[model samples]
Target: MTDILIRNIDDDDLRHIDALAAELGISRSELLRRETKDLARRHALQQVTLDDIRRSVDLAQGVLDEDLMKQAWG
Candidate 1:
């Protein structure tokens, strides 16, 4: 992997990051990697199956109940 350096992190931010690393029993670098992976996963979910994402447009127009989506699509 390539190294990416981030400068100008605040003291409080560093402390919080360190605390998270300690909480998860990881090194600070591993903690940062996990954090980035989590952030990417959160955004990536939008691109993955969420039951019925195509229904989102119909949802805005009051066309479906989310609870019923599985039965409808299944």
Candidate 2:
């Protein structure tokens, strides 16, 4: 496994992490690792949702344009 060093964390934030770690019965390092992984997972899921929305918009636009063309010709 690779090692990572983070610097300049706020005192309040460190305190919060310590409290959460104690509640979960885990070390601060483990809590940070889990939180980081969760954040990455959520960000990836959000990107997938955005892509789906873009595809839906493109599909809807095509359908709307086809309907408009038919109405104009009819």
Candidate 3:
């Protein structure tokens, strides 16, 4: 694991973060770590979902005639 140093956070923001960490019974570092991991996981899942959708669209292209598509959509 690598260390990250964030500089110049506002005092009020730091206090709020500390309070939240305390509420969750975790250290501030642990709270930040968990949130960062969760954000990355969600982003990866979204990318996978988008790729699947694009693949499906590619596979479906030209399978339907234009007239049929228009009628189905309308």
Best by TM-score: 3
Cα lDDT, model 3, residue 5: 97
- lDDT tens digits by residue: candidate 3, 1-74: 99999999999999999999999999999999998999999997776577798999998986678987887688
User: Candidate 1: global Cα-lDDT?
Assistant: 0.82
Local distance difference test, candidate 2:
0.88
Per-candidate TM-scores read 0.59, 0.62, 0.63
Flag regions of model 1 displaced more than 4 Å: 48-74
lDDT of 2 at 26: 100
In candidate 1, how many Å is residue 74 off?
A: 19
lDDT of each: 0.82, 0.88, 0.91
Residues 32-52, candidate 2, lDDT per residue (tens digit)? 999999998999777657779
What tens digits encode model 1's per-residue C-alpha lDDT throughout 1-74?
A: 87889999999999999998999999999989878889999998767565576676556653366757766677
Candidate order by decreasing lDDT: 3, 2, 1
Better of 1 and 3 by TM-score: 3
For model 1 the TM-score comes to 0.59
lDDT of 3: 0.91
Pairing residues by index, what is the TM-score of model 3? Answer: 0.63
